[model samples]
Target: MLKVLNAGNETLYNNVSFNIKGQEIYANSLILICAAPYFEEIFVESSTNFNQTYNDIEPDSFRVFLRWLYGESLSQAMQNYEKEENRDIFFQICKDLLLASSKFNISTIKELIEYKLVTYIHDDLVYDNLEKVIELANEYELDDLFKYCEGLKDVIKDEADEPENSNIRVTKNNSRPSIINNLKLRFFKFRFFLKTRTEPGHKFKVIN
Candidate 1:
């Protein structure tokens, strides 16, 4: 009852349609209608790393495969679903699809991954995913991916140092004047004077 489209050999289920132009599996309205539930299950299961698994597929072929997998267009596939469950499921699918595309050495997929990383820079969960993305980009020799990851290192480092309750301020007491205390005071005064005299707007003013 379910019609299966095969990219390899350009064939359809029951061998009803055959062509040499290329194997593009087009799901009919009836097939999409009947296959929604099954497709949903497959999408969920394969949503994690499906793209990496099919990395050997050529770009054109993979695009065709994607078209067959999602009855909608690429733009539609990128839309955020309303339902929480659907949104989560779709993102998982997109992640898997990107991984698969990377595996296939697809430049477009690499760019997409970079875009996603830049877009989600503020996400706490992005670091782990970005690590993997960096590894993939390195392995594939994707220059843009490498640059994006390199830039992300600074962002991640800043985040790591930004703790709410970790500030430490030391106070000095003038009650006891030791050599160290005198030196510290002199250094503080020198720094303050330097800051005051180094203003760009008053560069021509002489410091007394």
Candidate 2:
């Protein structure tokens, strides 16, 4: 099982080397080719001489990719970095994974990252966060995610544009009160009229 040969057990099955950030990471050539077609060109059939330096991608992102390639569930693999302290780094890794998956042409990782990013939407969703995700969605051709983020951006924009005094009633001449507020105002007026009516036969007519 690929899971048994993961991480620290590098000496067990590794045949190809990747130099990421001056750190040497090793993996099985067969596994890489089988997992992503991008590696098929790098490692020829049964050839052992393979070493590549990757300067564009972060080491953490590459590690996550390898773990997924080595039979780890994407969710389970991300659990280690899901802490509050690691939240920022984890988000960056997910973003990097999108690029890495794109370069490798791996749809599974891309789909998982899309779903993971979508989970970020909520009542407290931030505009900047949504903006970044939306940009990534468009760049990566994630149409569904792009649409969702675009809609959420509009919703958040509308909410931000709302007046701070939105809950406060406007002047009667300026605007109509909300239904509940109108009903409460009518009840208060009727109560005042009744109170006045009891005073010395006061002629208080309840006007509609």
Candidate 3:
């Protein structure tokens, strides 16, 4: 059986602290090292500081990753976000988690996120979200998912080229844009994440 840790509610044996964008999150070093072995280097016995800071990652996304680290089902966490009726937040979290997983060498989470994202795109071909996914897939070298998104792009092109669908209604979120006749699709700005560890005693820090 998995021993699940209640994130902020846990008091016992929570030795490491992650200060992300002024928010303090506590976790067990053992759990983190077990999930991602490279963390073992960051949480060394010689290191006096137990706090890690990250400006690049969102607190919500870090919490989602921690939940999975502490044995919560990823699907359940995603479902909770989906029930909130704000799918943008849900997808954003997935995107962030995918990046974090890749950085931490957590292949399981990375693969799961890729599958989830592609599945979501398949279900709903939202224009903006699809474009973002395409960028991530291409940048991250996710060849298969990138190819799938390219196919979706062709579908979008076909729909956009249709004169009858030129006046599709635009929503408040602008998720569905006007047909390709007048719509100009632009790629999202690229973001870079950097992690630095200058010395042995210094804790790891992520800078955007």
Candidate 4:
């Protein structure tokens, strides 16, 4: 697959361009169809001759996922995502990646991301972040994390719970800002460079 991507011969015929937030990605329909049923549907359903593109997707997220589809490691795809400045949107980006993975039937990537989400939530367990955790738990249907949150909720219920110990038993999330809530327009932008090489028939061939 990487050979064809590098050689660019196989990508020439019947390719589609995905328009993501003004950035374009040209991919082979057959390969994408074999990998993801959703892509098959997208190609089969298109009624135009200009090729199909999904404008709703985030370009950076798609680029990371597209790199993974070609042979890059998920960890590499997530490396920039783990930066301190991007931490607040990490889970949100993960969630977006998860959605894309699910759409593309990328099980390995999906499972790894799900595990990361669980670990992040676990590490963030506390009263000040309970509601944020709970909201994400519910959004992702994270049963174990929700149970942990419930246990902490019970601590606040019991009058015997110490007021001095706000460690894990911190107050509800309403008192503090949520990471998701604080995510602004800039946080959603996962900027990355896309290498391009011009090919025949006006096709935008991917080089890296």
| Best model number under TM-score | 3
**Residue by residue across 7-62, what tens digits does model 3's lDDT show?**
45266677888897899988888777766676877887547667889888888888
lDDT of 2: 0.64
Candidate 2 TM-score to native: 0.71
Residue ranges of candidate 4 with Cα displaced over 4 Å: 1-14, 44-50, 53-56, 101-109, 122-130, 142-145, 148-161, 167-208
- Give lDDT for model 4: 0.53
Model 2 C-alpha lDDT per residue in residues 105-168, reported as the tens digit of each score? 7765666676667654331256666778888889989886787767655554554467763443
TM-scores for all candidates?
0.37, 0.71, 0.72, 0.57
RMSD of each: 20.6, 21.3, 10.4, 12.4
Query: lDDT: which candidate is best?
Result: 2
Candidate 3 whole-model C-alpha lDDT, 0 to 1 = 0.63
Candidate 2 minimal-lDDT segment of 10 residues: 199-208
- Compared with the true structure, what per-residue lDDT tens digits does model 4 show for residues 4-110? 54443345752666777776666666666655566655776663533545555577778666656665666666688775467567766676776676566554554
Clashing pairs in 3: none
Q: What ranges in model 2 sit over 4 Å off?
A: 1-12, 45-49, 121-124, 165-208
lDDT measured at residue 177 in model 2 versus the true structure, 0 to 100: 37
Which is the winner by TM-score between candidate 1 and candidate 4?
4
Instruction: For candidate 1, write residues 73-127 as lDDT tens digits.
Output: 3333354532334544434444555655554333344444344333332232245
**Candidate 2: lDDT of 14?**
79
Q: Give Cα-based local distance difference scores for all models.
A: 0.40, 0.64, 0.63, 0.53
What global local distance difference test value does model 1 have? 0.40
Error of 1 at 186 (Å): 40
- Model 3 deviation from native, Cα RMSD in Å: 10.4
